[model samples]
Target: MKKIAIISALLPLAAGLCGAAGKKPADDAVARANGIAFKFYAAEAQKPGNVFFSPYSMYTAFAMAYEGAAGSTAKEIASVFSFPAKTKDLRAGLGAIKKDLERAAKDAEFVQANSFWAQKDFKFLPAYLKTLRSAYGADAMQADFLGKTEAARRGINAWTENKTRGKIRELFPQGSLDQLTRLVLVNAVYFKGRWKAPFKKEMTSEADFTLDGGTKTRVHMMAAPGTREAEYGETGELQAVRLPYAGGGLSMLVLLPKEGRTLADLERSFSPEKLEEIRKGLFNQKVKVFLPRFKFSSGYKLNGALAGLGMPEAFTDKADFSGMEKGKRLYIQTAFHKAFVEVSEEGTEAAAATGVAMGLKSMVMDFAVFRADRPFMFFIEDPKSGLVLFMGRMQNPAAQ
Candidate 1:
């Protein structure tokens, strides 16, 4: 597992560093919390294959502790991870991640691989929860925290099954979850909307889609007419485009290889910063949106990724969580995250009725064209906390 390497690298540093004299536990806590969040996104981006994980849920739990312990050492702990003494504006840093999120969300094939990993990791949840409570104090934990944890776990499982159209079950199997786990908080968000404008199943025709190599394979390409926010740029020799979400709060970003360049070359040049720039510069423009009707799922084990990002002490059994409770043995054994998303022409619908009506008549015009043909990334974030509630990548839409 990738986590093994992270632990190996940080064990030495964790042992050497003692609690700074009169150091506030809150500061360390926040640092640890934010470190974990940052690592999830960073690792997902660095991993060779399609990647997806939820840093939002993880942050929500940590945020609960930060809020509950406000003015105490816990607040400082949250700040460490959140503010990162060295950074000026954490929001700016997060905003820059729009591209990566967009890529992960839109890529169908990547989503499938990610969901497989998430389901596999669900098997170890029982032992994982035990380790959490043992390290953090029972008093420091809240009843709501437990409830949310359970709900989030179940919600993800349901989403996984739904996204897979019932092909997979028990994304997190029974007997895997625990009630007494020392969890911080739970953050869950589910999005199941059809495309604003449904494609005429007949319009979908097989076409050649360029892959990583020079080979061109036939894929079912879904074309539509719509107004989408996008940007044109030349990062080295590749051509790229950015697709913003409804409110412009987040976006789906794609990098297409220049005529002669291969997808591999574009992938090689991809970076968090470049992705950010693409998002920042996006403007509403009229264009032909061609994509594939694909579906996929993804799962991730974040323990190692987080540790490698400079949060070593929390994962080890010897780690100190006294601030949460004096003399309590607390260490994070495993951090598991999973997500599922589908983008089609079929959107969501709601209806309301009034007791008194005058010749009631209603007309609804719900039309949108979102064709996700190539690999793309996406994220659902809490605008206030800058917390990423859900994140995923899809490379295939046909699976849906």
Candidate 2:
């Protein structure tokens, strides 16, 4: 199967906020949800692999479900997602933030989509539908989950594939959705940006990449000559670099851990506050940088991981999605997420999509010389909305 991932670990250490008062609440909500997400990753350190995800995708998909959640179900979802106490505020903040993000992506093909699917004949509450349409830009569509489950699955997969520019397909997989499925809230985001200071293709050459286990791997190292001033930052354990795209509105931030320190080590101690410190302290300097050419896709089964974040009620029979329908019979059965990213001398092409079976539950700047020759953490974001479009760590750049 292709690489599809559930996004919960994208921004364990992202530290930036929205400037507008209206968007601050939404940013705060995502920030808190990030806390739970990274914590879940730390708790599941036993799983072996590099971290990759789109937390924004997961947050928005869940927010769609949270709108219809009532009583403890709503409370649990809010607590898990770190939403503000009031629903009105959450909606307003999210709306402002969404509009700002949509506006800030002129430089990149940053497309975001949301949708709601319910079994045919299910009477969805008007207020719930309105919340999805108004606050999340989603329209509830009736599907015959009981009579045409496979067709419904293919339709959803097709929608996700189209929205993601064919980057994410087969998100639900065979039999993942069934006749018992009541509702699914979907989110898709696509981003492709060319670096303002593109690396010359001729400069890419063979280099040795050191893996965490002390294994050496041959990879294509991309070099950028030290001519133009670059923004950079470094502390005891990390070196950071900011590469602006064709338009200055969006950029990619690469965080390389110092020698002898592993990306896993930084992840264990990382936080939004620490990321902020790095962003604030960067300086402009002349430096030679080497980044490996990497391309890979990732997918995850998030049911267990999300349950670790608290809010198991949303996944089980106890889920209360009454805001969606009169009876408290709907619950989330499964959730799926897939992400794709490619980094070359030209620029970066990344896309991510999320699906929530609500059947019922569940950036920076600095100046300094930076070389990302080793495994490192990176994020592509639009600072205006304080939303991370893609976040992942590269272990073996040679691996596709």
Candidate 3:
């Protein structure tokens, strides 16, 4: 989906208010959704340096997390992710989920109740009408609909601009938005920091990268000797690595196609469940990493992928968004997602509050530098919510 603009006025009035509140739980939900979305994207991007993440997965995860929090009829929640032929299955899913939440509620019940509306509804059973009215005014509700539509557009544009450093424009195009839209949520997190150890420009040299179909391309490679955690795993035929962030709380998982393996194979096998497995199996180890400072821009149309994932109803005019109003005509017209990412180990400098060098050299260093010259995957997440707001893979930096 090149331009994904979901305007969901039917998003249970309570959910919309909770989402708009910008509370910790909402933020956490967004982040977790982002993380799940990124994993799917990374798996797809692992193909032969031509990988593009799926926007459908990102949108689905976001909708699911929101549904998990907002108390909506099982059918309503499923509609947000896509439509289901049998509402029974959705109710079953919700029943199973409710049981899980009931157990979790026993401990940290207060925090859970406050953070999750579903839990709140089950526990306190607040007056839904009063909460809805207080949380959203008529004007605010109208504005929310308009704001979500525009925000979705802005998000795709921002990701494209940020990743490509301003190469792609209007990923969704103009006039792609329409009313009766069911849902629109976006998360844009960026990290532009320096490396603890900078690469020497003179040491950078041309290197051969194995591409798909037994092809080879000469690219500039940077090498650094540092204590870094690395891993090797498989998403079908693709080989991947997990690079931890500075705090070790989160990691950047990079997937690369094995020699002769196409990126498509990896994308086909990508899923949130698989990603969680990969994350759990990641182990910390020391290694000498060699990578290129590369940049590349990509655009994707995710309608097909999303529809394939059991969310087919939102795409058509037949979509029922009655919750938005007793009688209203609304459906998602289009979904477009475009993103760009550049990774280069070029030197970067930053100032710190304390300037001290507690080393053998005893020299005061007031700045930090970084050079990202390798194809890498990265995300910034909240430790509590486990959300990943921003994610990208950079294969070529100069081109971007």
Candidate 4:
């Protein structure tokens, strides 16, 4: 007899209708909360140089895994991610956003995909699998982790690479997964879109960009073909602007620290509430835009960072994820994330992938020339949903 029983069997669902028995939050509130959570995440994980990652990707992957977690392990994850107090609400809210994002994709080449893989020999709770499949659109696929660890790793990496249009590769690094691995949850998000008003390639020129420490470096600065009307705002601390993508639904919100201030200063004081204030303060006006053309990729081993965010129990043996399976407990073994982004005269192309290996646990902008000659923060987001697709900072575009 089979140790694990497949109830409904994995089937593709149009949207996540995870079987949580509560009302979902109202009007993109879950996405907004995730955005706010990312603000706190940035404050904790950001370093001195260029930094980029997809909070959306991380949130979705973790949310899928969180569905299978039990006890304090689940509570810690909720605290760290700012998930809704009710499991049903969180699932419903995320499902709504997932459906909305799919609809929004018509305006841009935006794609988000998720999958859940379990060791075929292991026994997981049927309810856990059902919630993941229904609420997250992640069908459960049985993998031979004990006998084919390498093959399993390759299979997961290939799925991520394909979903991200070849932008992100090898999300599970060498030796990252081993025989003890029993489950893996993955999420990939990719976006390619042109600006509503693109900068003419001819207008791009070599310019001196000042670093926070008074160091100056040469960078290819892109300029809008001419003055354009965009969402703009400024406080005594910084200048902010919104550059819409091809569709008005999404935009890059850029925040530039004032002359006497530094990126660190802006980051240190930032919060989701503050971001809301900035969004409310913006006005539409014609402004000059100056952005640097840069491309870079960032990868992180998220165990330490996530622990620092107050979810230490998820990685330790004390973790209770019995909801995933009835027998031996599974703790997070590894959490990995990789992101790639390129901003240029034509538009922007960005991709990100996040993976959770059981054994496992883991872990924008804008414009305003509105000139980004100095270091600044940027976010690619859905103005209507208040979902931030990407968040990053450009310290030295010349670095990579």
Candidate 5:
């Protein structure tokens, strides 16, 4: 029995919004990663409440696809992601960031996995496969995508479920894969950590959580024990707080809109520079914190969203992925993603998985008395690298 190789790809994170002056290759890559994180957030925000997804997972999956793209296909991807000019540079930059993430994850449980699944008899350029193996450490697995499509789909889903500790399942869905599917690239990320100053269970109680339009609902609002010192800051728009995990390297950053300010206002003005400034302004202070214990999962077929973001060619016949194969040009067929998150008095656990079928194209916070009684943004990140492992907004903890 041939087994799929498990690649220790580490994970991804972000802080800076755009490419700043005097930055190294890895720093540039991280900045681009953060850029896409917000870009995707804006696209998703157009929809209604409670948006969440792992930027690192989605970025990693598409990065692999970009390796096998050529001509305008590659250019569009590079432009959308702000990828490094050279393929070798992109690989090296992402690899360096992965190592740093691994180092920072000692006190937390952070796992990243990548896989390349191909049609049993399909031929792909050795260089294309080599890039995935060497750069992303993704090992290939054979599947009869043209024959036993359902079995192939189930196998992939099972692998994803196991990798995510059962948090994500059925990523491809029935009929999502077909005979034209020649390749599938997958990236899954999982993070588990306990807050440094956890809220006492006794402090949790039912409270009214304000919703959009000033409507309210009951939620299990958790309170910090007395006045706990945390990284706190405030601006005219919002209040920010950093909740460190057991290991000092990773922490959750929460941004709560000011009393009269709407989350939409803070979101519209949110930028990398603003985030950096807020971070720089944070000071350790004893603060009263109230947050709702919430759990929710999100799923999306990112094809339309990616195309809308300026990479429409990747999904059409005009797309050129000749770098993957010479005779038959390949275009993206399907792009799928699923994510889950849980925030409680004890800690937080988040998992996300992304799959980009070659036939496809697709594709936080803060606090204050610091009370998040309404919708707020949150990020699970490596404070040092500014890598966001997971991020989302809590609209209604009562719903899930």
Candidate 6:
């Protein structure tokens, strides 16, 4: 997906529910979180084969930990997440957004869950727990990471699978957790929705798709009628459209670059400001929509990427999460993210799970010709709420 997608999802935080607690941040923290994620994804991680991930999931995971951060560590995380410097405002804002998301999820086949797995008998500050539960809807579970590490891993994985309807499985690779692991915080997001205007299965046909390196392959391009006055726009080199789901709250946005341009070319200049302009540029229009049917899963080990985003202290001995516990006993060792996405004639299905294992350790728019026959970016989000559940690019549907 275009790096801009991450920034867009953050907009929801800025647009709080009508009756949410306190006033929302004037500077838009969610946008800042998305920006940090893109900086890391573009420069450090994002691989080519149909990239799919939930910036929401990763950011929420870190956010839970941020509640427990202190000193410069807290300052750095606040900067990274665009959190209000005042703790109470941060809680009120996120708690309000969480309530809005819960209400929206109840109206659709959507689920976003957060859980905290702590070593048995490890004493964590109660205030930290309270904030996580109240602001993020996180549940705390005691696990024997100090003893039955494998079993703890299995339990966490089971929670993810059940929450995501099995689309995500075995979130933590074997050996990801062990005796030294003190706390594991995880967030899982799942979404299944039908298109408001479904594409005809019979209209799908073989079409040529070009990859970044000039490689071309045949792909299953699906088509739907285009006189619907959909949300769409185009620039000289790029086209974008927003394809809404059945509920109207969520939509899939596709970004297609012109023949001579590449997704990388569009990405290089994608910043929060430019992203706001593109979003504002969307207008109702009519055009044929042809999208390739593709499904893929991506997994990332995030130590390097998080460091690249300027929170290197969290992974080192210099870390301080004292607000969570005494003696500064925890530092993130590794962070893992796994996501799955599929789009076809009927609709879209996406799920993502993100976890951080501590050694005390720690860590788009739419349419025009919008024909995604070439390398392109895509993202699924709630326009009203500004929540981006999934984002990725189908650079080469046939790659893996």
Q: Which regions in candidate 6 have their CA more than 4 angstroms from the true location?
A: 1-29, 44-47, 102-107, 361-368
Off by more than 4 A, model 4: 1-28, 31-40, 43-46, 360-369
Candidate 6 local lDDT, 1-400, one digit each (tens):
3121111100000000321355454125455445554565576324545566787777778777777778887787676666667777766655656665666555468787888887778777888777767677777778887679899889988988888788777778797777778778888888888888889998899999987788789999999655566888778878888998886777887778877998888888876566556667888877678888887777777777767667788777788888778778777767778888778898988888888776654203243366788988777765655555566777777654
Candidate 2 lDDT for residue 53: 69
lDDT by residue for model 1 (1-400), tens: 1110010000000110013466333323323333444446555655544444444334433332222221223334344345333222332333233233334334221111111111212122343233323322112112221345466445544544444344333444343334333432222323332332344566668876644443455677766545443443434454444444443443334455445654445445555445445545544444456665544445444456545655544555444434333333333434444444444444211110000000000101232233334444544332222334344444333333
Write one digit per residue (lDDT tens) for candidate 2, span 288-328. Answer: 67888888888876677677777787777787778778877
Which candidate should be chosen as best, given TM-score against the real structure? 5
- What's model 5's lDDT at 43? 82
Model 4, span 1-400: residue lDDT tens: 0000000011111000112355344354544445534554465435567877788777777877777777888898888877766778777777687776666556789888888888885767788888877777885677877799899888888888888889888888888888778888888888888898999899899999999789999999999666899888999999998988886877889899988899888887787768878988999977888999988887777778788888898777778777777653688888888888888887888888888888632203333457889988888877766677788877888876
Report lDDT (CA) for all predictions: 0.37, 0.71, 0.37, 0.75, 0.77, 0.70
* N/CA/C clash count, model 3: 35
Residue 302 lDDT in model 6? 74
| Collision count of model 4 | 18
Native RMSD of candidate 1 (Å): 15.0
lDDT of 3: 0.37
- lDDT, candidate 5, 309-350, per-residue tens: 889888787787887777545788878888888888988888
| TM-score: model 6 vs. ground truth | 0.88
How well does each candidate superpose onto the true structure, as a TM-score?
0.54, 0.90, 0.53, 0.89, 0.92, 0.88
lDDT by residue for model 3 (241-283), tens: 5544433433345655554554455556656556557655545
Ranking by TM-score: 5, 2, 4, 6, 1, 3
Candidate 2 segments exceeding 4 Å error: 1-17, 20-37, 40-46, 360-369
